[model samples]
Target chain A: MIQLLRTLGHLTVDGVWQVGFATRFLFAMLRHSGPSFARFSLTIRELYFSGVLSLVIIVVSGAFVGMVLGLQGYDTLQRFGSESALGSIVALSLLRELGPVVAALLFASRAGSAVTAEIGLMKATEQLTAMDMMAVNPIARVVAPRFWGGVLSMPLLAAIFSTVGVIGGWFIGVVVIGVDNGTFWSQMANSVDFREDVVNGVVKSFVFGWAVSLIAVFQGYDCTPTAEGVSRAITKTVVYSSLMVLALDFILTSFMYIGK
Target chain B: MNRAILDLWVGAFVALGFAALMFLAMQVANVSEEGTRGETITLRARFEDIGGLKVKAPVKSAGVVVGRVAAIRFDPQTYQAEVEMKVSAAYPFPKDTIASILTSGLLGEQYVGLAAGADSEMLKDGDRIEMTQSALVLEKLIGQFLFNKAAEGGSK
Candidate 1:
C-alpha cells in the first residue's frame, strides 16, 4: 500500500513539474523567435522540408476519404429519398470535422515526428552545444524556424485536403452514383455558409497547427541527448500532438455549435 | 538542394495552398455571391406560434425562394412572435400578401411561404404583413384529431 501511494505521488509531482517547465520553455522560445522572421529563409527551408514533402499523402488520403464519405452518405440518404443532399453531407463533414483532424493526425506522424527526430539528433550530436558556445541562441536559430514552418503549413495542408475531398465526393456522388449534378451542387451551395462553416473550419485548422507545432518543438528541445532518448521523443511528439489535436477539436466544435 | 531551387519550390507550394483556399471559398462554399445579393426590402409579420422557424430560413413564393427570415422576436404583452424577413427588391409583393409558416418535407426544415393578394399598393421596406398563419404543431394536431374522434363516438 505504501509503495503504491508513493508511486502515485511521484507521478503527480513529475507531471506537474513537466507542465510548468513546458510552459516556461514555450515563453522562452517565443521571446527568442525574432530572428526566425528577420531571416525568413530558414523558415522557408523548413517549410519545404515539412509541407512540400507531405503533400502526396495528404492529397491521396483526402481523395480516398471523400470517396468513402460519398459512398456512405449516398447509401444513408437514399433511404429518405433525399440523395441529392449527399453533397451537403460530405462537404460539411469534411470541412467541419474530418479535414483538419485527419490531416493533423497524419501530420503528427509524418512531419511532426520528423521534426522531433531531427532536433533530437541535433542535440545528441553536440551541434546545439557548439552553437551555444559560438554565441548563437539555438532556440532562435533552429527550433523557431521549424516551429513557424509547421504552424504555417498546417492550415494550408488542411485546406487542400478539404478541397480535394470535396471534389472527390462530387465525382463519386454525381458521376458514379447518378445523383443529379445540378441538384448536388446547388444543395451544397445552399447549405454551406461561408462565415459559419468554412471560416470556422479554417479557424479550427489554424488552432490545431499552432498546438501541434508547439508540442513537437517542445518535445524535441526537452528530450535527453541519446539514441534511445531521440526515438522516445519522436514517439511522444506523435502521440501527444495527436491527442492534443483531437481534444482541441472537440472543444472548438462545442463552442462553434453551442448556439445552434 | 540549392537555394534558388528551394525558393522556387517553396513559392510554388505557397501558391498552391492559396489556390486551394480560393477553391474552398468560391466553389465549395457560397462566398462569392453572399455579398452580391443586390438590394433587399425588409418586411415583418406576426404569428401566434412560430414553431421551429429559424433565422435564415427561406421565404418562398410560387415554389421559388424570394427571401430569408432575418430575425424573430417575442412580444410579452401580446404573447405573439414577430418575425422579420428580407425580400429581394426585384420580387415585389402587394400589401395584402399572406405569410404562412410551412415545412418543406415530412421531416424537413421550416420556412415561410408568401401568397400574393390582389392589392394596388406594393409592399415597401418596414411594411408589416397582416395576414399571417401560424405553424402546425404536431402534438396539437394529434390532440385535435383524437378529441374529434372521441366526440364522434360519444354522439353515436
Candidate 2:
C-alpha cells in the first residue's frame, strides 16, 4: 500500500507536468494559426451541435432547478418572515454558479465524451495518419474547431439555463405559490448586478468550455489503436473534464472574491 | 434531401422560439427596468452585510414590493454595504422608516425589507435610511447556537 501511494504521487506529478506541456502547445498552435478562418467556420458547425442541439436538455433541467429552488427557498423564508427574497436567491445562484457549472457538466457528459470518442476512433483507424500524410495538421483541423466550438457554445447554453431557470422559479414562486409578482421581480432586481455576478457566470462558462474541449481532444488524440482504448478515452475525457470544471470553478470564485 | 432541409428549418424555428421566450422572461423579472417608471423615488440603506443579494432583488413592505434595489456598493470607511433602492412613488415612506436585511426562507436570498414608521415626514430621493439591519448569516447563527449549548453543557 505504501509503494502504491508513492507511485500514485509520482503519476499525479507527471500528469500535472503533462497538462502544463499541452497547455503551452495549444497556445503555440493558436498563435501560429493566425486568424484560423477555416477553424472559425468549423467552430460555427460545432456551436450548432453543442449549443443548439442541447437546448431541450438545458431548458427542461433549468425549469426543474428553478422550481425546486423556489419551493425550498419560500418554505424556509417563511420562518424568518421574509418570503419575498426568493427571486434574488434563485437569480443570484443561477447566474453566478449553478447555471454555468451544471450546464457545462451536462454538456461534457453528453457531447465532450462524444467528441473524444469520434476523435479516438479516427486516430485508431489511422484517419489522422492520412491527414498527416496529406500535409494537414490534425490539431489545427480537428482539435481547434472543437475547442472554439465548446468555448462559444458553453456561454450561450449557460445564458439559456439561467434565463429559463429564473423564469421557472418565477412560475412556481409567483403563479403557483402565490408570492406577489411585484415582490419576486423586485427582490431579484435589488439583489443582482448584471455587470458583476451575471458577467462572471458567462466568463466562467467560456473557461469551462475551453478546458473541457481541450481535455477531450487530448485524451482522444492519445488513444491507442484499439476499440477498448477509444472507449476508455471517451470515458476518461468526460470524468476528467467534469472534475476540471468544478475545480476551476472554485479557483475562479476564490480569485474573483480575493483579488478584489 | 427536401425532408432533411424541412426538418432543419423546423429545428431552427424551435430554437428561436425558445430564445425569445427566455428573453421575455428576463424582461418580466427585470427590476431595474420596472424602477424606470415615472412614479418611483430612490433611497439608500446601509448594512453590515448583504448576503447573496442580487441587483434585481425586490424591496418589500409587509410582503409587498414597495421598490427594488437599484445598486449596491461597499463603504471604504465603515466597511458596510450601501444599497440604493427605488421605491414606488405611490408608497409613502416616513423619514424614520426602518430597513432590515431579511431572508425569504431558511436557505433563501437576502433582501432589504422596509417597516414604515408613524412619523409624518416623508423620505426623499437619495436620503439615507438610518435604521438598517444586516443579514442574519445562518453559519454564524449556527455557530453561536452550538457554542451556547456546549457552554451550558460544560457548566452543568
Top DockQ: which candidate number? 1
Q: Residue by residue across A205-251, what tens digits does model 1's lDDT show? A: 89998888888988888899999999999999999999999999999
List runs of model 2 lying over 4 Å from the truth: A32-39, B1-156
Each candidate's B-chain TM-score, in sequence, is 0.86, 0.76
Q: In order, what lDDT does every prediction score?
A: 0.91, 0.79
Q: Residue by residue across B36-150, what tens digits does model 2's lDDT show?
A: 4568888998888887776657788998767778899999999999999999888879999999988886776666799999889999877999998888888988999999999
Going through the candidates in order, their DockQ values are 0.76, 0.12
Worst 10 residues of 2 chain B by lDDT: B20-29
lDDT tens digits, residues A1-260, model 2? Answer: 99999999999998998888778867865764433454355555666666667778887998999899889988998888788888888888888888889998988987788788888999989999999899888877776776676666777778788888888999999999999999888778756665567668778988998888788777888777699999998888988998999999999989865565
